[model samples]
Target: MQLLQKFKLGKSKKSPSKGHANYAYTTARVRAMKSKILPKETYPRLMNMSIDEITRFIGESEYKEDIDELARIHDGVDLIEHALNRNLAVTFTKLLSISEGDVNFLVGEKLKKYDIWNIKTLLRGKYCNASTEEILEAIVAAGRLSYSFLSSLAAKGTYEEVISELANTEYYPILKGYDGTNLSDIENQLDKMYYAGLFGTIRESKSKDRKLFAEFIRMGIDLKNLVTLFRLKKSGIADPEMMNLMIDGGLRLKHRDIEKMMPLSFADFVSELESNPYWDVMADVVRPDMVSLIDIETRLKKHRLKSAASFSHVYPISIVPIMDYMLSKQNEISNLRIIVRGKAANLDDDIIKEQLVI
Candidate 1:
């Protein structure tokens, strides 16, 4: 209790100014953490393992503590899923704790997605009358909001109470718009808010590494916009108003350029994308006749992770390496989940491999 109180007191406060970031220490710690990520060869090995074998495999790795802690209540795939989320939460929270000043602030900003994710989870869970335990299991408390607070929100008797509980947070205004319906709208709005906030933070920083980080973010926005464009085109929605789904501030693809492509047929859209810089990332998987956007999305994600890994070495004692480690760690967790869940679902090994970034 005392330690928790101390953490809330010291870690809760945002750094007052730019201040000195403990980048050397933070990046060193991040380097050691990155070394623990599952090797590329591990995924192929995991694919051939049965669920039990897979569970044992992770249980013996860095996830051992999480697996042991959650073993009593959850078993099989459920146990692995919960342990993965818990480990992710603990790992990211450790980053926040170990970092100071600007590093802490930037890390927190990047992680706000978890907080947003928790809020959305709580609301969605309440909307569908899911039990608190079920809602809590879906949560990854790797953000600014503490799990205790999110858990309390999850336990709220009604959505109104949940919204009221979050009335003091930055998301309150948007939360107030949730009228038991429009969950998707609210979710989109919250997502937009997150990217806007992150972009705004980056724009305010003039540091060289931060500028590079901003480029990384812009690249993500471009990919997200491309995904949205593909989905809209696949759904046959040629309406220009769909542009509202497009985010601003992309590194290469501009808002005007996306607007121009909104009315094009899927074939034309693919043709148009060929001239764009991102085309190279997914050209092998992209085609107008493709039935699924899955391949394109996977390729794009892999490219982004690979790009971050490449950049991590360029600037060692800056936010770049830390960000790279975070992305790599996230990819590791995602890949493991894909293999374990895929095996449990009896998905074909080839199909599972298609989804894996490694």
Candidate 2:
């Protein structure tokens, strides 16, 4: 507690300044949050429990407030989903609140990506004609947009109205061309725009902290592009048009390499990946039909988690640890969701293990 007070004092001293003080505060808060992430063994236990048991388990854990509040209105998977979103919102909003300087600015910018997510969610809900309550429940609430703004957009009820509401925000210009299209097209456009903005923001940021954030984002993009490339190849879609779906700024593969690799046979594609930086990490999974796209995706996520964990220690005072904790927490949630669903479906243990990313 004394150490935390000292750290908080250091942060407050720098809060009024534009320099290192903000980073200190953000890093301190992030470290505290990281300490609260579930242990690895928690998921295996969650997997064996029923949905009601799972809810009770989470209620006894860090998600207590959210679980308690949502329990009255929802149950089962719906309850878990709402609790997750609410907890995400509370956690991220706290980050914004505690950060003082450039750390605050950087986190705010990175979080704008969530705005893009919310917009896409709203658009999809509108297109599907889903209820406002359903759309509201689906939002993650970890973005730069206020809760009121997101709630308003979700309640608007029409694709055009949602698009028009977002027009005044940073995402409006990028999504303008895709207006009135299918929800998938809108989703794709939003993804492209969000990533493009992320890359641009990375380039503009001069702080070492900002650079670390960019590397994490790049790692994610690389994994996503690799997955897309492999999936398209497996589906027998070799056209150049398919490459358009791949995002840029990956540390491992360039646009040209992605384009070139698209034409390769599955064997060649696996060999190409095996020879890259991810080779040693992914080498064990490179055999015959056993290497399904889902397996590759799971491996990629593992690699990213490992990479993020390593990077966290490389610069302890930066945002990397916070980002790593966020990813790990989300992965824990995803792993639990998969296990619960798998158990509920009565899948065999080996089959369930095969599907888990952990």
Candidate 3:
């Protein structure tokens, strides 16, 4: 709590209490946080180093404090992973606190998605028969939901109890029907409800950031749909079942688009996607140096990051910049983990770089 209060989530007195957003100071704090993002040049240098060298390199960077605290207990990639997740959670929790008024509304609404994630994580852990400690480690702790709340959720002995605990949230309605079904189906319900809740908020929003956030949500939906479609296609699932699995509200890949691509082979769908606005996002599938589901998903995530950065540059004072920084912080944690783990495994530099979202 002391650490959380110390940072104050980039808040300053300049933040508005009502009416308008406090773009000035809100962005000021966000910019400072964004500065800590790994430079493009760093990846090139780190790729050549061994795992020990990579750990040493991270110790000298912004991760130094986290690395220092955990170094005595864990080493190598595990140390890096724990430190990074801790840092990521702290950063995001700060963002949720500092926001106010319109900025608060936007950030808060977006952060609710993390609660959905926690529910999913708990359900998954219970379904897999994973121990409570194992489930606890997998949590990100970045959401508006408190650490205690999530911890309690993780300790639940059954999926029904987990869902019952979440009954007060929007997720309960969707999950209630699937109490006895497979966890995968329940997880799929959570995903659909989350996107649906997002679009519902979008409908009620009157802020300038509405269009920006709407697009961000759409990009997420499209990527999610693509990933789902590909997996279902590979499984030989029928169109109706695949459609049920996909969440709507995607920007480029609409109902018509999905309908058109459903009957075609995966190659044909990739070719069809190449000509649309989603080409850059799906480009990894059409032009990957290392063809893989992982590569394709990484590219899609990178596209969203680049788009957020570009949007923030053009609209610096808006909510876009804050969201951009928050996302960049999360991606930094992930990218560092990728590099650390990849280096620890002694994988080739190119292979590691291919998996990076930056």
Query: Who wins the lDDT comparison?
Result: 1
Write candidate 2's Cα lDDT for 179-226 as tens digits: 566668767777787777777767865557667888889888888887
Per-residue lDDT for 168-208 in model 1, tens only? 99999999999998999999999999998898788765667
Residue-pair clashes per candidate, as listed? 0, 0, 0
By descending TM-score, how would the candidates be arranged? 1, 2, 3
What's the lDDT for residue 90 in model 2? 82
Candidate 1, pairs of clashing residues: none
What is the Å distance of residue 162 in model 3 from its true position?
Answer: 3.6
Give one digit per residue, the lDDT tens place, for model 3 in 1-358.
4246337634552422344456688888999989978887888788777878888888898878888998998887788888887777777788877877677767877777777777778878887889998888778777777878889988888888887888787667777886565778777777666677678767765456777778877887887788777666555565665567667788877977887778876666666767777776565466412245776778778887898899899998888899899778878777878888887777888888888887
| Number of residue pairs clashing in candidate 2, backbone atoms closer than 3 angstroms, sequence gap of 3 or more or interchain | 0
Evaluate all candidate structures by whole-model CA lDDT and list the values in order: 0.88, 0.77, 0.76
lDDT of 3: 0.76
Worst 10 residues of 2 by lDDT: 12-21
